[model samples]
Target chain A: MPARADATSPWRSVLAPSWSLGRGADPLPTFVWPVASAVLLAAAWSLAAGRFDVTVFPSPLAVAREAMRMAADGTIWEHAGISAARLAAGFAIGGAVAVPVGLAMGLSPFFRRMMEPFTEFFRFIPAIAMVVFALIWFGIGEASKLFLIAYNAFFSIAMATEMGVARVERSRINAVLSLGGSRRDTALLVVLPSVVPYILQGMRIGMGRAFATIVSAEILAANAGLGYLIYSAREFSRMDTVVVAIVALGLLGLAADRAFVAIARRLYRHTLPEEFGP
Target chain B: MIRARFVEMVLPYLLSVAIMLGLWQLAATQVNPLFFPRLETVWRSFWSLASGDLGAQILVSLARILAGFGIASLAAVPIGLLMGTVPAVHRLLGGPVDFFRFIPPIAMIVLAVAWFGASDVAIVFLIGFSTIFIVTINTEAGVLHVVRNRIRAAQMMGAGFWQVFWLVVLPSAIPHALIGMRIAMGAAFSTIVSAEMIAGDYGLGYLLQEARTTLRTGNIFVGIVLLGMLGIMTDRVFRFLIDRFGGEHAGSR
Candidate 1:
């Protein structure tokens, strides 16, 4: 609806002075909004927590205490670091392999057809469902966890790269060829530049998948990681600890995503699209 | 002509499938059959299970996936529309959504088990948690991206707030929401196996959980195959719906 900040609507008028939906400067600036929002959210949270047992629901303060305790003992950092390293390694390997493979798929019909059945089938199999297979193949350790994350990253990146490559104009390739460029030069100089944005986007998405899959892998079978922390907390009925770990996962995921976009912008400033920009 | 067409399309797929199976068969014979089950063994295992509660397990998992995805998509659309149309709603909920959306749904299984127990409702909650934000954000973006000129046109025709919404915004936003739902469906499938494994008693994930304990590699393979089939089937259905209903607005996002 075109709700136009109607003067007759009382709620609109009341909240308008604060949130500044319409225009110009606000009584409450942009910076203060989230801080205020967080306060409101925390207040509501603590109120809800107060009605429930501590074991069932923990207040923000209680969760903070637990987070502080984990931090003090250095367990949270240990888990977070392990998870981060695993995510980095998996994302790197998956991107490195998927790009060239995806390029081949996009460029050559023979390769595309030959790879399609495998890609189409494996793409549907959830990474979480592969933990057992990972265990069976890679054994009981970091290898399985890294494999799961890389498995999750691979399909998304490869698919995006393929799409990007497919979208590259034939005329552009011809133009490169007309300029006496070799096939290698056309691919490296023309196709790769066009595909970089898509690759970066795929990497961002793959990072999210890595983060998502990492927790489950850790939860299922790991000595340490945030997922394991949450899993162990569930065993103890420590809602506070679970809450803290979840928050950590959220922060880390968001930070990694933002960091990815930031780096992509700096490195591929020309090729990176505005979607990657602020 | 028919043979040529078949060679172009059908043969490639057959070749691909054959190559993969041939490689697996080769491994089973060359390596350990315990780890690498023969195709026949896996097929037999799958057949035995398919004759059993496999139908019920598939149905249970399917029901939970649809239920969770449906609820989250439904709830998200209205909220997303509100957020897009109204500033107060957007400002109020934006921070919370930004924070919560990144929390992996697997992380919620613990809280879900604690709160709802290892039950259907818990599994549903986990799925719903995974999908809600994706749909909501997509819906909101759809609304935001709606051409301002269209709203102006509706206003020129003397459409009221509700009329303009029903006429202009909802239609424009729905396809975007559909696209979001499609992506969220991917997330939904990606998370369900874990949700079921963690807290389920009778889904395919639960079956995998059981197989995991016994080292029943054949059963595990069967479960993965079933899940893949389900995934592909749902994807086809979603694509069909998007094409049939959403049309121009669909797939643009």
Candidate 2:
């Protein structure tokens, strides 16, 4: 399949440069260095733990044990699952609304001018700052957490969609129209397909923002999730549990990002026009 | 013609703000005041706070962001330059940098609080730690984009490596570094807010938390609006600096 060529395609920009850089590297040294550094870091941490106060900074082994215990009892899974579900629902809700609104904005100059300032202003407002407003409006329920995540994701997706649509090739649309395609057909088949990669790029960024917001929201006002786990453990001075929660959050973020990459790859494979042959 | 064009350009923004305020007022009247304060009430609170405690909180948050962002920029720029210029250094540090980059700064609040004990140092550490990776990566990217021919020309002119790096490479990379610093500033600003909400006593984040506890929706709105304004104002300052210092590199990209 042929990928549409555009200077503003973020996915292409992110992936293209790295591939060329990786070609000449020896794989063995590459693997050895990262693993060696990981081992070195662990050794250093262990040494520091032995010298310093364990209450403040637990050993790597202690953290591993805590993680195992959490896993054995399924507590870690419960927290992780709740956080993941919230992230998914928020991304879905935000992306669904943002794409259509962004399309309208991209297609109509008047609409774009009307919405840009308001959205831009809100975009600068940290999602963390909205926790209180969310709490007041939605209370200390799942709604508040979801709202925070969705709000953060919405602006990112909307901006990405608008840019993507605005950058869609005029020639492609003209060709479609000359081929007897209606205006609606040109929008659905030509413009939307061309902008899919940009929308996906936006979703990727939005997912990261949503994860960050969820952590803050949970810390501020939640009974569950990884943020809550870390906060509650900290309250009791459980440094080991805190480390375990941090590691868990990192791993979950990595997993979700990898999942997104895989899904995006599949979508690109199916949707990219054949003329821009891959 | 020019006047009409200017109006056409500006009218939508004004109309949009008006429409939003109108809708907000409409909603306020329908909902309970506790949940959604009237627009006028929120506006009054905004004005009062702007002249009082909000100014102090804004200063506190700004100080924290600057401290953290300043430290991150100082550390990241040199290291990023080294990584870009030296292959061995990049290989040695790239893995760890990428790993830490995946872990959001918000997740580190727990560890930060534990290590630094809810002090300004903890917030600074959180912001700095989160920002360093971004600045480093962007700096490296910027350095990599520097025209190799220019460096070779400097070398051919009998300039030492340090001289070439300081004079040729550094100037070319400044724009990207500046962009990274702007991004880092934004990140630090938001991270400090979250950190404050968790452990602070006097920042805007703390004020928002306090307002939430007191069920003062109007005060919460004030805090949010103030934060938005602060962000916009600081961003404008960065844009001005970038344009002033970046020269040909500022908007060329």
Best by DockQ: 1
If you assessed candidate 2 against the hidden native complex, which CAPRI class would it receive? Answer: acceptable
Candidates' TM-scores? 0.94, 0.89
Taking the tens digit of each residue's C-alpha lDDT, what string does model 1 give over B22-92?
99999989987767889999999999998898999999999999999999988999999888777666787
lDDT of 1: 0.84
Question: Please, what's the RMSD in Å of model 2?
Answer: 7.1
Candidate 1 — which residues are off by over 4 angstroms? A1-27, A268-278, B249-253
lDDT string for model 2 (A65-168, tens) is 98899999999999999999999898888888889988888988889999988787898888989888787787788888878888888898888788889888
Question: How far in Å is the alpha carbon of A265 misplaced in model 1?
Answer: 2.8
Flag regions of model 2 displaced more than 4 Å. Answer: A1-28, A265-278, B152-160, B245-249
